[model samples]
Target: MAGSIATAGVVCAVGIAAAALVGIGAAAAESQRAAGIADAAALAAADTLAGFAAGDPCSRAGEIAAAQAGSVTACDIDGLIATVTIETRFGAIPVTAIARAGPPL
Candidate 1:
């Protein structure tokens, strides 16, 4: 009976470790998604600011972020450069990402 209990305890620990790994992987994927959205939003804003696209820079950034199920919490434009910060949810936690796009430097 003692050996059986030990085996069960080991199995439970392994199962818990697997679950934690899966949760971590999911959070990482969500973070990557947010980063990608931030990049795209920044690029859109930069393109608009550079006159390669027609629209207000921050407005363009908001549109791009919204399409990807994110919200642009902040946007800043400097000359032809654009920086964008976006927020999205990862499970119950809030995930935020920032990106800057502009002429090659």
Candidate 2:
């Protein structure tokens, strides 16, 4: 009976560990998704700033981020450079990332 109880406890612990790992993986994916959105938004905004596109730069970035299932938390343009911060939520947790795009300088 004691050996059976120990086996059950081990199984429970393993299950819990597996669940934790899955949650971690999910969070990492969300983080990566946010980063990608931020990159795309920044690039789109930079294109606008460079006169290759039309519209407000930050507004363009926010729109792009929204289309990608993210929200733009912040956007800043300095000369030809565009920087964007974006957030994507997984459950109640918010994952965010920042990216910048512009000419090399």
Candidate 3:
């Protein structure tokens, strides 16, 4: 009976560890997704800001981020450079990432 209890305890611990690892992996994936979205949005905005694309730069950033299942939290344009911050979610947690795009200085 004691051995059976110890086996059950070990199983429980292992299960908990597996769940934690899965959660961590999911968070990492969400982070990466947010980063990609921010980068893409920033690039799109920069293109607009640089006159390579039409429409407002920040609006373009919002559209790009929205298409990727993210929201643009902020966008700023400095000359030909564009900066974008985006937010995405993993479960109940919010993941945010920022990126800047422009020609070489």
Q: Give the winner by lDDT.
A: 1
Looking at model 3, residue 96 earns an lDDT score of 95
Point out the higher-scoring one by TM-score: 1 or 3. Answer: 1
Which residue pairs does candidate 2 place in steric collision? none
**Candidate 2 local lDDT, 55-89, one digit each (tens):** 99999999999999999999998999999999889
Question: What TM-score does candidate 2 get on C-alpha atoms?
Answer: 0.95
Off by over 4 Å in 2: none
Q: What are the per-model C-alpha RMSD values against the true structure? A: 0.8, 0.9, 0.9
Local error of candidate 2 at residue 104 (angstroms)? 2.1
Which tens-of-lDDT digit does each residue in 1-105 have in candidate 3?
Answer: 999999999999999999999999988988998999999999999899888999999999999999999999999888998999999988888899999999988
State TM-scores per candidate: 0.96, 0.95, 0.95
Stretches of candidate 1 off by over 4 Å are none
Q: Flag regions of model 3 displaced more than 4 Å.
A: none
lDDT at 43, model 3? 96
Candidate 1 root-mean-square deviation in Å: 0.8
Q: What C-alpha lDDT does candidate 1 achieve relative to the native structure?
A: 0.96
Worst 10 residues of 1 by lDDT: 46-55
State the lDDT at 83 in candidate 3.
90
